[model samples]
Target: MRQGRRTGTTALLVGPAAAFFLLLLVLPLAVVVIYSFGERGAAGGYSPAFTFDNYLSLATRGQAFLNTLLLAPLGTLLCALVAFPLAYFLAVKTSPRWRTMLLVLIIVPFWASQLLRIYAWLLILGNRGIPSLLDLLGMDGVRLINTRFAVLLGMVYGYLPLMVFPIYVSLEKLDKRLLEASADLGAGAWGTFRQVTLPMSIAGVATGSLLVFILLMGEFIIPALLGGGKVFFIGNALVDLFLQSRNWPFGAAIAVSMVAIMLATIALYMRFMLGRSGLRQQALV
Candidate 1:
């Protein structure tokens, strides 16, 4: 009787959360999946008939998919490269007094809306901005805005904070004695950092990379504003499909595909990270 009561209490605690998950996440996803296999109406919105045409027609948006696949990883990598040194400086180099102030500086940009930040980039990269300055230096017709480079620049700028904080936390949690031990054992600065510091802080790097990659994969706003509708991504394609074209079935199909791709990508990434982590553990042992 007591065990039965305990079971009931546990169920009572879990029930609301389970219901919320089912009602919100699971229900909407189910609806989208069902709609993905359906047909579009004559005017707009979804129709009841089931068909494979929507998924089959996904090839039409191949360019957008290609662009997303290419840029997202590239941007993530760039963000990681830029963030690592900054994160290292914060976590290792700076005194505790200065570190807090510098971190605040990094975070201050996020207090403003992302749209406003990108708009600022837009002005800086526009014709009469950087290009005009370049023209004075005899590099006339230099264009920075509305290109793949502009999109990449915005991506790195916007996502830098996301990349930094995770890495900083990871490095902060590192045991300092390990470095001291390495030095006492006659390991030089480079060797100490390579074997001790890097391995200890890799979790941060992995976390930051994954966070940046996932966000970049679904990024629409930066590309839209910076690319000027020229450098398209899957997010842009979905926006156009659902909102502008009102092709719900097709949009749902693309959304489903994007989710699948992201899942597979993340799984592979995790596996790789785990394998590397295992190797690092064995090496340390």
Candidate 2:
């Protein structure tokens, strides 16, 4: 039948992508789960024995877990705060030609390697950089490099583009007539924005925040490079466990725990956002 031929063709088109997904993503996750329940070999790899000791050992890295939980949300909040205004202006205020140019400028940094960007930040924020300028200004002993502040700055700069684009897309797709309607109903600028503009852009804000938060949760490079091995996060702990200590089982346990925590956090956050929106809708009506 023609239907049979069409189905065969569809499968043929999708077969390689499906195979790659299973082979690369699903299989590696399955291996990690299997290794998490196994014993660590004497020679520094997984051994064929069932045990929960690895999961229990996670408590030893509690400080790393605490540090990550603190820093990740802080970075996500700052990213959202800085990006929203920039995105709104670009989407709502700027001329089309200038908007295109500015958006491109925002994304241009992403084309280069993230590592190279962070390394550039190191020199700019180092003793020979910002501190040198401060010294000339009579503010001696000012430090920027290898501190928590440097880590925060690096994370915000690195993740700003990811945060901005989603919000810009949302604001761009917004209905402008609603603002006119709000104004016709005697609403002031702030009132119109609060009742119409902000509500409509909630989807974009939620999407951008979730995207930034999820990535920040797994981020290791910013803390490692900017924090200069002085700051400890679960990501750094995982790297040490797998590469330095050769503790595969414990590393798998940490990864699995991180996945579980992120899923739970995201679910709760979505519920809160949806509930708040529902309440706002009722109030508006």
Candidate 3:
């Protein structure tokens, strides 16, 4: 009777979440997968027919794939590079008062609309903005907006807080005794950080990187607003296919392909990070 009750309680707790996941996520994905195997209708939506032509035609959007593959990782890397030091400073260097205030400042941006923030960046990087400032310094013909650089800048700016908070949490929870031990062994500042601080905080770095990279994969708004259509990502391609061209089958195929790629990449990343962490633990032991 107790076991039965426990099982019932477990099901009660998990049933809602499982149903929500299936109803929203899995069902939609299943529909998309089905649509991907069908044909484009006479009008705009799907038609009941099975074919591989949609998948085969993915080559036409190779540039979109290339751009997304390159930019997403690059943007994630840039976010990690910029966020690490800031996170470290907040977790280790700052006093409690300043840390709280600075953390609030970091998080305040997120409360605002992402579109509005990107639009602000659009203006800042426009011809009359930074380029004009550079022209004042004799760097004429300096274009900031509508470029890959602007897209990357926007991505880094938009995603930095996501990267920082994860790393900060990791570093904050790190054992201070390890640092003291490293110092007691006559390790210098750099040595202590390298041996103790960095390795200990690797979890945060991995978490932050994963968060930033995954989001960057499906990013459209940043590139759209900042790149001004000069740079196209897979997300943009999907938008065009489904909305503009009304090629539902092809769009579904692209979406499915993107999901596959992201899944594979994430699997590889998790495996690598886990292996590295295991090796580090062995070395520490």
Candidate 4:
């Protein structure tokens, strides 16, 4: 009787959330799947007629796909490259007192709206900012804004905190004695890092990379603002489809395809990380 009561209580606690998830997430997704098969109406909304044209039309946004595919990974990679070192330093090298302050500093910009922060970058990278300084040094009209470099820079800056926090957590929780043991076995700093540190931090790296990659895939505001409407992504395409063109069915199709691609990429990444982890375990043993 006591066990039955306990089980009932547990179910009661979880029941609302489960119901909420089913209603919000699962039901909506089922609707999208159903809609993806349906036809676009003459006025542009879902219709009952099933067709594959929507999916086939995915090929039409090839450039947007190509751009998103290229940039998202590249942006994630760049963020990881920059964030790893900062995280490593904060986790392993920095004194605890300074580390807290520095970590706070890293996240300070996030207290402001992201739009505001990106706008700040616009000022910094604009012709009046770095380019003007360059002009003083005899270089003229160094155009930094509205370029791919600007987009990349904005992406790296905006996402650095997200990347750093995960890595910091992983590295902070790391077993320091392992590094000592490696040194005891005559492993140099770089060798120890390659063998002990990097391998151990794979979870954090994977987490940060996946987080950034998925977000970057859906990113549009950064490209629009930083790239000055020149650089386009699938995110931009989707925005146009829904907001500008009001093509609800086509927009739904694009969204579904984007979700599918993100899932596939994340699955591949997880598999690769797991394989690497297995190899690392073997090497350590």
For each predicted model, how many residue pairs clash, with residues at least 3 apart or on different chains?
Answer: 0, 0, 0, 0
Give a tens-digit lDDT track for model 4, residues 1-285.
999999999999999999999999999888887887887777777778688888988888887888789888999999999999999999999999899999999999889999988988899999889999999999997999988889899999999999998889889988889999999999999999999999888778878887888789999888878878777888899889878777767778888988999999877877787665663342221
Once superposed on the true structure, which residue ranges of model 2 sit more than 4 Å away at CA? 275-285
What is the TM-score of candidate 4? 0.89
Q: In candidate 4, where is summed lDDT lowest over 10 consecutive residues?
A: 276-285
| Candidate 3: tens digits of C-alpha lDDT, residues 1-285 | 999999999999999999999999999999999999999999988998999999999999998898899999999999999999999999988999899999999999999999999999999999888989999999999888988899899999999999998889889988878889999999999999899988888888888888889899999999889989788899999899899999899999999999999999988887787565773342221
RMSD of each: 3.2, 3.7, 3.2, 3.5
lDDT tens per residue, model 1, 188-219: 99999899888877777788888889999999
Candidate 1, run of 10 with poorest lDDT:
276-285
TM-score of each: 0.91, 0.90, 0.91, 0.89
| Candidate lDDT values, in order | 0.90, 0.88, 0.90, 0.86
**Candidate 1 Cα misplacement greater than 4 A, ranges:** 1-5, 183-189, 276-285
Q: Candidate 2, residues 60-139: lDDT per residue as tens digits? A: 98877887899899999999999999999999999998999999999999999999999999999999999999999999
What's the lDDT for residue 66 in model 1?
88
Q: State in Å the error of residue 22, model 3.
A: 1.8
lDDT of 2 at 197: 86
Candidate 1 is scored at a TM of 0.91
| Candidate ordering by lDDT (highest first) | 3, 1, 2, 4
